[model samples]
Target chain A: MTLVLESQLPLLIVMLTLGTVAKVRTVGSGGEPGALSRLGPAVLVPGRMQAPALLVCAAGELVLAAGLLVSTHPFFRWGTVAFFAMSTYVLLELRRRRPDAGCGCFGEVSSAPVGWRSIGRTVALTGLAAVSVWSPVTGWAAAAGWVIAGPPPWYAAAGVALLALLSPEIEELIDRVRYRAPCEQRHGPAESVTLSKLRSSGTWRAHHQDLVSAEPYDSWRELCWRFFAFRNHEDDDVVFAVYLSGRRPAVRMAVVSREGSDSLPDYIPVSA
Target chain B: MGHPSVERRRVLAAAVLGRTGAVPGADPGDEEPLRAVVGEVLDVSPHLITIETPGGVQERLVIAPWATAWNGSDTTPGDLSVGSMVLMRTLRDGRVVERIWADTTRITGTILSITGKKDLTVELDCGPHRGHRSVVIPYRASGRLQVRHPQFEPGYLFDAIGIRRDGASLALLPATSQPPYPARSVPPPPPAYAGTLSRIAGTATWSDTFDEEERGAAYPMLERTDTGCPKTGVSCAGLPYLAVGSLLQVRNVCSNRSANVPVVACGCMAGRFCDRCVECDTSPRGRIAELSPSSYVELGGELIKGCFNAQIGLG
Candidate 1:
């Protein structure tokens, strides 16, 4: 059990942090943003209890996992007790909101085609968490386990948990958010009113030259960009947007205007 | 019994089952949306606003609470406050205004494109209906790109910049002002700009931190990676990953709803694919009925939902 916990340590820590972070940002955000955002809150039932309950359950697992990894007998038992106690809290919360929702105690852990014995282990572990808290002896065992293992194990666990993915990965995503498209429900339905396509290409004196000289990129890709040129009376002036996917394009930005519609300007400026 | 879009395969998922399996995370545009001034309302259950375009077209829009609704209000449409302006994705929802935020949410447009060497050149495209139009964005901006593209040609009119709104409007929490990118005027593109066209392939990497107010606007991107799933049958490599506090498109494998969330937790595989999530075995159906204040993402395909961080592809 300890070895297993140790191996899956990174994932477990990430999960707990994720849970906490998820609850924190939206904790007080009120109802979920929409049907989409509501998915997290909907399950395990709704109300304040769900987030806290999940938090406790995960935290308990985190603590228990930490103890087991160290192989500290005393701390292990105590940690087990704490984990069960926490799980009990989670299950209680779940029961309050949704009794039918099976205890998702071991997410992906229990999903993979495992053996009957594994199921038994899961049942036992869940009982430890969902049924009741641990006894005094178990608590003592966890405490002792922590002693033998020392602070190093605890610190290591903490450190590993904090760093889930590389930093560079976060920097790689460039979201190009466009609104007022002809249809939000329709995919690939962006309204791109080009100069030539708009008959407005005649006034193309080049307003976005700044972006042209921004830099000499090594690569780029056309994620998605288009100027909205709906009705001449439309209020949207969305110029084309180019997110550096792989390489830089020759004309990075373009204005969306009708053939003769100057309701705005022939071209706007691009700032690097 | 089932959705026609699903059976007809007209939806984006038609490709989901394709050879390459249409990649899941694809962002639409670059600048914040300009739309019908859906007049604002106070504390509407789902936060509604009336968007009135210059043409006097009044369309209704649903929005999230400002300040996280960490604070709520009950002001009526008649009590329109100064704190309302929506930064939205320029996509319409059936005629009902549908970008994330259309009211009071300020938005900016950042332009990026490919250069000769196959690297990405990003430019800041900003301002209202008139600020930008004549010129194309240059290849200069602060940030990095993924692997260089193969086609090292030039003169490619790749794409534009815009914003996606989470609600109809958002406020500058007095403590913080507006986003960093200010509107700038620029000269026209060199005539040769069109002559430098080329085919490029790579990724865009926007830098950010916690104070990343613009993270919601530009930091998150959909990656076009050719890399397949890991042989072990797992990969978050290609989903749309968001920066901290940015909205994430998390698709639940069990239920079909793709939850759009903030980047509370980082360090995952770019938040591309979530390998772990806290789930309840509750019936997705029952939960759906109970789940109120929802936004429907009408994709070109069917709806797939679940708890948070749901993955869309097959194992």
Candidate 2:
């Protein structure tokens, strides 16, 4: 088991190096300024210290990568474990705060939100780092020797490098395949009576001022339903369930009152 | 060793499937029925013509005796010669040239003048006829031209794909241009939200052509169109960054009207919209999100007003 896990060190080293380069480039380009700014708050850095915080983050990534590559000492191995543990924490916090925000972990190349896949990847890296602590190989020299004199030839290094380069793309592809709806299986027609149609309705015009926000209620169903929240216009919070249904394409709207409870069933249905 | 009858059946099956005797599993149906190749004629003979494609690949194709040829207008095969830029359509065999249009001229230049609201006087700055040469683009021919400009004006660059007519003038056909629409200025997005939601403010407008036309061009990755997104697809030359399928919450800045409209088209200056008059700027700021006419009317804005100021937000 140790030999099998130790054999993966070359691939992990390549992936970490590639990730470090990507982070350095992203910091230089300021591609995800929003994500970078949020990082300042996540790590308890001052808001005004965004630039220095980003530099520190980049430098830390470089150090982690260098330490993983050049040293097999318990300090470097433990440092790797701590570094990935910190990364996993920061990513989870960012995910909790801004679920829609780009992870910016691999830079501008990926826009995937920090989700289970990212956390899973970090956990895997942490496990790998822990394994590296017990392994005899230390530094690029030993790893290179392993590749040259080991069972596999130098061509295996090229394959590992190629796989490392494609890691971000593979992650993005996994996200797309997992989350994106297939074309044929889409819920409904591309265009439905959305807020535009609601505003066009006579009932909507009369109650326009009481409007608050239009939130999509359900996406899994064949028809996408949106809940339009409105303030108390006639002494009650108005909730409008607007969606397109039936064969002959028409906008269906139902008004309800939010008297108590946050559930949809708690709202009392009212006619428009 | 197979039986004689089995061997005969196999041979019969191969023949029925249109497989060549020399190559097993090769399907004759794999050959395209009709395909086009554009190149400059290097050599021409009664039986064949050798041409060099734009990619520097030289190909020699056989010309069928019954092949039809046109150079701007209908012409005999005898008229085809060296140095002619030809667009050739070949049959399934690939060797037989079926139809060929030779010396088809394509020009990219700025409009020098407009005559009678139809005819255009263009100064050729690129293509075969370079160096400020004036060419008259007739009104009758302009109708066939696929122009995307918001307005026709001088100083706007155009790409005219047509044939050179009599007297060195170009009979313009399908064409595209980069119209000059002032880029709509967009305000900087708001600071990152501590929560899971973020919002920004922008204006909204409407159009009636949403359902009838293909909106896939605006968001090429999201929507797929059969007729080539950038060419025969809808104009997304308004806001290049806004994808077609994105949903936005819009609230009227002046009135109490608000709605959620999915972007069905891109109004950015691209493709056909690129042909608008030179007055419109093609910058990335001051962008407009167009809506369906019904959407506009529903948003409590008059149709005649064309556009209304509204705060648009994306989560």
Off by over 4 Å in 2: A1-5, A32-47, A150-272, B1-315
- What class would a CAPRI assessor give candidate 2's docking? incorrect
DockQ of 2: 0.01
Give the count of colliding residue pairs in each prediction: 143, 31
* Structural similarity to truth (TM-score) of each candidate: 0.24, 0.31
TM-score of candidate 1 to 2 decimals: 0.24
lDDT of 2 by residue, B1-315 (tens): 112222122222222222232321111232343445567889888778898987888999988898878775577666786787776766654567867777554454445665655676666332111236576677776655535444456655454545655446574554433345421211222222222223333334333334421121122122122112322122222221223334445655555555555544434222222222211222222224555543554454433233455544431
Question: What is the Cα-based lDDT of residue A192 in candidate 1?
Answer: 28
The lDDT leader among the candidates is 2
Which digits, one per residue and each the tens of the lDDT, describe model 1 over residues A1-272? 34223332333334344444444444344331221112222354454456565456555556665554444355554555454455455555644564444344333111112223333433344433322232222333444555676543553354333332311112222111222212111122212222233223322234323233222111111223222112112322223332222223222232333233232323323332
Question: Which candidate gets the maximum TM-score versus the true structure?
Answer: 2
